[model samples]
Target chain A: MPPLPVITGLGFITSIGQDRATVGRSLRELQHGFERVEFFGNPNLPVKVAGTIKGFDFPTPSWRDWRWPDRFTVDRELLRGLAPHGVYALCALQQALTEAGLEPGELGDGTTGLFCASAGSPFMLGSFLGQMRETRGERGNPMGVVSSIAGTLNFNLATHYRITGAVCGFVSACASSSHALGYAMDEIRLGRQQRMLVVGAEDMTDESIMAFSSLRALSNNPDPATASRPFDRRRDGFVGTGGAVALIVEDAALARRRGAHIIAELIGWGQAGDGHSVTASHPEGAGLREAMRRSLADARVNARDVGYVNAHATSTVAGDRSEALALHATFTSQGARPRVSSTKALTGHGLSLAGVMEAAFCALAIDEGFIPGAAHLEEPDPVCTGLDLPRTSLAEAPGLVLNNSSGFGGSNVCHLLRRPA
Target chain B: MKTSAPSPTASTEHEQSIRHLPAPARAAFEQFQAGGDPATLDPVVLAILADFSPRASEIPLADLPGDTMLIDDLGFDSLAITEVVFAAEDLFRINITNEEIVQVRTLDHLRGFIRAKVAGRSAR
Candidate 1:
């Protein structure tokens, strides 16, 4: 039998923390990183706060002018064609590769692959096109389209990191990174790649954030503490956050041979589309339930053995209820009640970034012997009655974990992971 | 036009050197210089192009010669030239076509094109 696929390294440049140590502390302490920002200088952009990042200062849109943090030494010339999220992704990759003990030449192995996700850099896109409009389209930025489109991360990362093997980008709205993670795992398990780096990020500008306000999917809660209460009865809509996350997945034998620290085993994954609506999910979370069931079957693990479920509930009324129904249908009928929570309650929904970020969260839980609880969950919605929704962090090791991620167009993806044995 | 000035090499300069200035740009440069009232181009164009030059870190922008080849000496690709053009457009508020600038090979050639475009803009 082939060696199993396992996550050997993790890197996070998130609002919650820039490194695993800080992230572990934040998760253990149940603290959140939320701040108010002027959305494109407009005071009235629905939500008032987000899980915002504070370091790696850039004085201008030109990346050459950026003052990178001390931990990350950058070759500024390589950043000329990258967008904001692309820049964050590169930094996250550096951290991940360093943690994995892989040098540049090793990462350049033809057997290695990179699967990345981002909704593109809307901030850069808006600025690029807006400038073109002002110029009457007579002139164009040389790097405009490359840096602004949904494939920005792929273009910038594959080129900068010298990835000689398979490189791909996933774009299923918020489920984008989860899809990337699953595909990366599949590539490794099938022996197509010795290693695959799954990474994702998004921009936090008004252009990126306010684009969702018209859909009425943003939290209007003025209070940051309770704004993203995932399963609470008072849940309105999701709060947004942006940063980057990277996880290095490789053959378990390869990792052990290299003495790499194995974080968790990526047991199985499943993806499905509701075919029901463009925005609203299936009323009964039909596709999500199918995804969860398929994931369990793929891993060949009984539903009862799953110790925790990182819920996809993003605090939206219909969304949370649908996921709850999916959970109840998937677990309750089988008399299985795994501990459930959405760390989005702490780190605001990261949109396209949620999948890989939350997957990294599950890995952290496995390694650190704790399950992140629903940070602000209170007064659970009636739909959540049967499912186990822990309101506080548990100090016990979560033996196995399933992370669920859902997005627009009724796309659902679930990844099941187990503690490294 | 065919009279050899000792160094009038045969074959079309257009087809010969992607690195060196083509015949048209050289002709344009000589024509403008012969006018006696040489145009005083702004420093902004040089400032912009210097940033895009790949050799800037070693040669330094101030040391690059006027007749220095942007492609060969300054090490600029087609995309880098386009970026230089974009910067010039924003600075001079004028438009330049790819066909008009693709054959330009030197800083002087670039200056001549910008002088003509800026003059045209002023006339408009």
Candidate 2:
């Protein structure tokens, strides 16, 4: 059949770390990235903590001046109109392209495409609403209009890079980026595009935090480090967070021809809709099971051959339990149950960004031969107990890994990644 | 995340300029003036200039010559010029129509237009 798509470059920024090396190191050191909410701290709110990126200043004049080199000069002034998610996507894409040694408009004959996933522009909407209230909607920031669009990230990146090929945006909630990455793989496999950049970005605002708090879907634990304990008995819910991740994906032959450093082989991708709930996952995890099975089947790899499973366990009572049931049904029935864990335990739930970040984590794990432990995972619940939820880093790398990502709308996406030979 | 627009720091002289401004403009300008450099700068004017200038370009805002042309000297494009006007409107909480914006050429001209708007508002 067609050649497998490979990841040539990876760039990610999260509460855990900014780059792969640093994130891997942090994982090994058992350093959790969650911290007290910096934006909003309502003492009465049930959730008081999040996986916040401390002092995150992207495109900030002073921050960029010191951090970015002259060659990477960007017109920060022009970007002032973009939403935070848009900025995060552009920054992540820049890093990925730089690492891949590609410049804007240099993607070889425009066969390059872009796929972006975002949890809408909540931050900009909030700011715009406030501005509208203050200005009585008569006068507000002109940029407010651009930032309010959900496709801001996709449109901004495509225009900035001049990627004249297919540009698409996916809004599958938490599974959004996973769907983006999966579709990018499909395009390459279908010979529709030679290269694609998959991006996932999110901007968590006080409104989002309050929304989750209203739903009682956030962890009430005041401790940032241990608040997001996936699969643990004490787990309450995911800690809200925001960040971005980008992956430069290309046809395996094209990547090898370009002599790009192949990070991992994206072998399979599967997506399914549970059709069960608007906000909650299916208790039986029927959709998740189908997604995993489809992913393995698409990869043409046996379930027994899989080495690790990056679970979409958000630490909520129903979410984690449902994911565990899906995992047990998908991997356990087959011989050699793969080790399963959720990096969300450290990075928390970055909404639309969660999928791609966790997928990137799997790529890093394969590249470095280290599987990160599910941080703060103590006293695993009986329903999730059978799975090998290692609390410490696995020194040896697995040959293949499965990344499971699901969203509020019962959208589930699974990706199978393999170590590049 | 708001774009890191150059916030206008009202100087003592800038604050003095507010006295001549109308009540609405003075109130708006005072908010801009709060917690900024006390140097003799008309922050509103300086902010409008700085917003349109290139980030790395050496455009000295503190001591701008009154005769400097916005285009030839500062290299502001059409869009950049529009952004300056928008920023001004947002800061001063005043409505600057497109027709009025086109007539503004120099930094001094723009400053005069703002002063006129504030004075016009006070007359109401």
Candidate 3:
């Protein structure tokens, strides 16, 4: 409605690297995080590779003191006793708040809202399912059912952060966080809240692994180095990765007054549904084209102003074709095409976390003046032959960047970002 | 072929009013089944499962064959099994007791259990 809010600070955790510098270096080098995991019971599932996070130590010691109940046991045994999405959201929020130099009480009571996008159910589901299967002959624990619901994560995150403002969770499949960011930006732009915390968190689980494997939508190229090759002709599918990202967005005037380091401005956002199939995207990329056009229109910027585009190309056979066609059509119609690149090749598909993680990358790209090329792309798809996908590195100073996320069920979102003058 | 036994009904009639779930709710249901194992399951289901299994790494779901004993075949201790049960109950919005859990040995059984709970709730 009003002028969109500005992103003051950003934080993300992914398999490629944790901090910005480390992740930035990996992206610049085009490093891949895929590797074979023997823990999955199926030795013949074809896709043995994944972009897994290693050596992450949780800061909360209280989790260790808690009782190892049925659900807790699942967390401990399967997830290595890590905190759920709610807890991760809180932790990421804390970091974003700290980066923005805001105290716990600074945002004032009931003025600070929490908005998040999550693709996975809480980590408790697998443990409960395993328990249900094992305890089939006995009475199951009552707490397991309660702890495993999807909404519980949002509720817990709000309570843990002591956020009194509106609390909403957006679940648009892979576009979950992108939509959440767009919504949060709109809320702040309309003067509903002084500050908003937007988060995208995911917890990869077994059901997710098998589901992708069954569809052959995962890269089976055992070598972690070459597993996720987005835009590459030999690309098989995406590497399922996990992580959380948090961004603190506030009014540009308010942030500058407080001397906060303004990273980028969220000028426009567009959301659309394909009304297409539930799993695959439309071949012509009609939904994606509309979303991008709408975003540019909302930003009041011409297509020529866009410096780079962060694509949602997950390296799938159908998905890549659809996205490429969409980009070509959109840019051709405007007579000005921007350089397009897919980061999923490096980070794998983070699902709900992808939008925010890539948003963080966009912010970094604007600041760093370089758009990382698609990681293992030796040859672009023939369908995308006409598109100007950056195979080699490009170091153009970006004035504006657009991030695209297309999810299952025809959900698509595009966010237009501008470098702060 | 004998049809599988139907699931238990929901406790309240008021909860049965809504039959079709919006995209988010359906997504949550699919996610519940793919818990903690994204590599094997469908991406849609994996997206849902990721919600609950944040720390879930790559584990093959095929190893968890329908006929495989949850404890013996899967090498899951009591705690792991309980987590899976909790996920099912939460996603399906049904109350599955320890006794009901004991009857679920395979993926098919788990799906049936959830369907029965939903059906029962709708019947009310």
Candidate 4:
């Protein structure tokens, strides 16, 4: 309904790394984060590997107010201190404020809002389920009980930042953060707020692994090095990964006048729901096509203007094929196709964090002028022949990039990004 | 809270009795065995529930008391209670109501609720 706000600053933590430079270096070197299961229980399960964040340390009692920090310990512990979705949002907001040379108290209390996306039910529920199984017929510890809900984490973040504006969590599965980003952009553009912090975060849990494994939707490769081969013919399935990514979105005019280092412009965002089955995608990629087409139209850019696509290919059988079909349809309609790549091969599907991870990738790509290729893509699926998927390494400079995140419940979202002049 | 009249089916009764699970009471055992026997309650599920209400594991089967607080005594918070209810429903293949959950706080009360609902459902 309104023009999208510009992204002023960004912060992200993934299996790859915790900061932009570190993650970028890893991406350039084609380093991966997947590894064999070790710490978590039942390592002998069919899906025994994941992209786990190693040796992360969150701020402790000595660093921050113990009471304030304890409230978010549930998420912090889950992430090993990489910052939960809400903490990530706060860090990104702070970075943007600092870059814009604004003070922590500058925006006032009620003017700043927080919108975040996450597969809310999974992490907490899965943990609770696991606990329930372990202590059958036994009463649970109160501390563990309160810490496992989706809302608690969001509330903790809002409380910690003392944000008084609208604070809400979106649970549209994988589209969670994308939807949150879109909402925050609209809020700023429509004058709901001059600034908003949007974030996406997820915690990898054994239940998540089991669920994906049950659906046969994960790569079973034991070698963490080559596990997440997106778009590769031998790609088994997506490797589950976890992390948080945050972006500070603000009104472009305000940012310009303030001399903020505007990283990229959030030209447009489009979201569509297929009303399809809970887990299965529509055969023709109807919802995905509409989302992309609408995003492009909203950005007032032609198909040819799009230089790269960050695909939502989780390497699942149905998901990969369906996304490919959708891309083929979108590009073919305009008589040209953009080079496509899947960062999931690098970061694993961050679930709720996938969109933000890809968004960060887009921002970095635009700034650096090179698009990162989908790692481990040796052979392409015959059904995906129509798409121009990059395989070898980072190649062409990207002027504009599109990040796609299609989730369960048939929710599809697309964000279009353009390099800042 | 207003308690709904108990249903007449076996499954419905089981679903309705979740709220009355007392400290250390076994709420979802029968249901957990619905798809044949599971050999044991899933360890992960047990661990999560125990974390929610430690007394759930601390209370002995012989010492199960009717008046113990699910939250205060057994540690079943709002979220934990919700999970327990869902787990029972999944195990028993029955849909439960929030009202029913609200009324359950003791082991006997939960058993009665499930017994009534299961009987009511079977009558149909």
Candidate 5:
């Protein structure tokens, strides 16, 4: 059997934080990263809040005008065909590679591969497509296809990094990055590649984010603090957010030989789908429950040994209920209680990025010796009544951590992680 | 993405393969791309080329006269050409067809193309 894949390097660019130290501090202090703003600048839109990303400039959705923190030096050529989210992903990748002591531009020896997930740059698509339509379909930006589609990340990132290994784009919506991570693990475990870079990013634009409001899945509450109260009875809906997160999933044996500091071991992962509904999960959280059980069984660890669970409860009424029911059936009702919380209560739901971002949080918790607690859970829902939803950070190192991530197509993926031995 | 060249290597090789043509074509391209005052290129057209040609900002836009190589002398890829065309269209309020974009190898070609379009529109 192959050694488990370990997370050696992590790079984060999220609403809550952008680095290990800042992210650790934010999670530890329960700092809520939210802001009230009229998406689309249209007063008629219902939702007025989001977990807005800070310290980035987006005067226009165009990548040319978009500027992240000046600390990272990026070539102008690389930005030509990118969207805002692509830039974020690249910036996050820089951080990850640096932490892993991997040199950029030299990672193309075929040992390193890249997998990326993003909802795509809808705002940039709107801009480019708008131009095409206005021009009567004659001509538009040449990079329209590579910069806007769901697979944009694969094309741009793979070509940029020049990875010769398996490069794929996962599009399971919110569960996209989890699928990427899972496949990356298989690639490393199968000895196909020494390491794999998994990146997930999303555009924080009216076209990209407010489009979800059409489904009424976004919080209508104007108050940023209480807008994303996952697992709470008063929770209205998930608050949307965007940015990028990245992880370097390396082979444990390779990492150990190279003396790389492993943050967490991705012991096992499992994925299942809810065949019942197109958008909603199984009413009883059947798919999620199965995913958790499969993950535990795959990891060959007792369910009772799992110390922390990063719940996928996104604060939506039905979504939270579904996840809570799944949690109860999987752990609580089985007499094995685990500390559970939805970090979404602070960071908001980052859609496709949720999987990798939450998983990275688990890695941070293990590395920083703190478990992030649910931020604004004043009142628990009836389904989550027996669940332990700590409303603040737990100042203890977690033994076994499970991160749950689900998507619109009823796709579900769960990962089991633990502190490196 | 569509670029002026089907491929950068192919375009560069194609231009260089023609021993005599590449120098003149490159000269014309360099003059216009370098923002040099080529008598055939209008100052406005030269400015647009200079601005969009990746690193041609240091080239004097409306001063020198002479052409330079066209393909792969610098890193101006196909996407940059599309951007140049888009900017030229918006600035001159003229629509340039793919055929016209393909014919423009040097800054002189671009000047001729845009000058004719702007002149034709004014005459109309």
Candidate 6:
């Protein structure tokens, strides 16, 4: 039998924290990062608050990093065109590669692959449109097209890291990164690649926030801590935010040979489409339930053996109720109930990064021996009852943790992870 | 046709080089130089052309002919030309739309387009 794929290196930047250790601490302490929307705020925009990473300091290329004097001109051009999401992905990629002890040349291995997820480059699109308006359509940046593409972040990471392997980007709205992670694990498990880097990065631009506001899919509450109240009766909508997460999955044996720190074993992954609605999810969460069942079966673990679940609750009325119904059905059918919580309450449903960051949190929980609670989940809606929605962090080591992520167009993904033995 | 000599206001190296070009190209350069609008100034055109030269790749900006077809002579694909248009927009503070780019077939056409745009902006 083929060895299971395991996450050997983890790096992420969220509204809550910039690294695994920091984010893990925040998760354990139930520290919420939602605050007033700083960059995307507009009086006309319905939602006034969002989760944002305050004081994020991005890195600049040094003389040695760019191999200056020789490739300075080309390097400068590339740097000039990088969008915010690309920068975040590159930063997280650097950290993950460093943690995996893999250099650029090592990433060039034929068996290494990259699977990245992003919804779109809102910031780049805004810049392009601004240029168009200011110049009256006369001229614009040549790199705008490249920067605005949805696949820009993945392409940049692959080219920058010199990884010539299969590089792909997933765009299933909020489920994008979960699908990326799922496909990456399949690639490694099926012997298509020995290692893969899964990345999820997104930026909250004014355009995105405004669009969501128009859709009434954002919280209007002014209080930062209570803005994203997943499972609560007064829940309004998700809090938009910018976030990124990266994980290096390698063949378990390969990781063991390299003495890599195995965060957790990626036991199983499943994806499904609702096929019911273009925008709204199925009323019963059919796709979500199927995804979880398939994931649990693929892992060959009983539902009773699963100890925890990190939900994709985005703090919306319909979204939370649908997910709750799905979880109750899936767990009750198996005659076992696992503790469930939505870290989105803290991270504010970071769209593209939601699944990947939640996966990162599960890996951290495996190492830290604690599961974070659903922050601000005070008055759980009666519809979202029956599951153990802990209001405080639980000091317990779960043997298996399931992360459920769903998105617009009714896409759903479930990734099953196991504690490192 | 009376071709005016290079303008006194522009003493850049590009202007000096333009004076030696054969009649038509040098006349066009003189007309652009005498316009006095910063958008159609010699330095701005040269900078845009310089930025575009690398993208055009086949010929250097210095040897570029005024009537050279964008795709035929300069080897610019649609995406490549889009970059050039963007560069031109930034350099001259003008906007060239997709439709306008289609009408621009030659370097001379591009110069005329810029001159007309500058004239319109000045009239505004």
| lDDT for each residue of candidate 5 in A1-421, tens digit (9 for 90 to 100) | 5767999899988898888788889999999889887776788877988888788877775554576787876666677678778878888888998898778776798888898899888888988899778656755777888888898888888888888878999999999998998889888878899889999999887887888887888888888879999988898889999989999999888888888899999998998999888888888898999999889998898789988999999999999899999998998877988899999998999999999999999999988888898898888898888888887899998889999999987899999999988
Q: Could you list the chain B TM-scores for each candidate?
A: 0.62, 0.61, 0.48, 0.52, 0.58, 0.57
lDDT (Cα, tens digit) per residue for candidate 2, span B7-76: 3434663554344334544554566456332221256566556645645357565467776777877776
Who wins the lDDT comparison? 1
Q: Note the DockQ of each predicted structure.
A: 0.18, 0.17, 0.03, 0.02, 0.20, 0.13
lDDT of 1 by residue, A1-421 (tens): 6758899889888889988899888887889888876666778666798888768554445665565578776654566677777767878888888888988788787888999999998777877888668656654567889988998998888887789989999999999999999999899888899999899999766778888888999999979888889989999898888889999999999999999999999999998899899999999999999999999999998789899999999999999999999998989989999999998888888999999999999999999899888788779998888888877899999988999999999999999999988
Tens-place lDDT per residue, model 5, B1-124, is: 2322111224354343222222444455446445533343365555556545656435564444435434445457767887777765554446677777888776556667777776665565
Q: What DockQ class does candidate 6 belong to?
A: incorrect
Candidate 6, superposed: residue stretches over 4 Å from native: A38-41, A57-77, A129-138, B1-124
Residue A302 local lDDT, model 6: 79
Say which prediction, candidate 3 or candidate 6, comes out ahead on DockQ. Answer: 6
Clashing pairs in 2: none
Global lDDT of each candidate: 0.82, 0.76, 0.69, 0.68, 0.81, 0.76
* TM-score of model 4 vs. true structure: 0.69
TM-score of each: 0.87, 0.84, 0.71, 0.69, 0.89, 0.77
RMSD of 3: 15.1
The parts of candidate 4 lying over 4 Å away from their true place are A1-4, A57-103, A121-146, B1-124
Q: Write the per-residue lDDT of candidate 3 for residues A23-76, one digit (tens) a residue.
A: 777767777666677535678667777666654432222233323213111233
Q: What is the alpha-carbon lDDT for the whole of candidate 2?
A: 0.76
Candidate 1: which stretches are off by over 4 Å? A56-61, A64-68, B1-43, B53-59, B64-75, B90-124
| Local accuracy of candidate 6 as per-residue lDDT tens digits, A65-125 | 2221221123333454556666667667767778888876898877899999887677677
Clashes of each: 0, 0, 71, 60, 12, 7
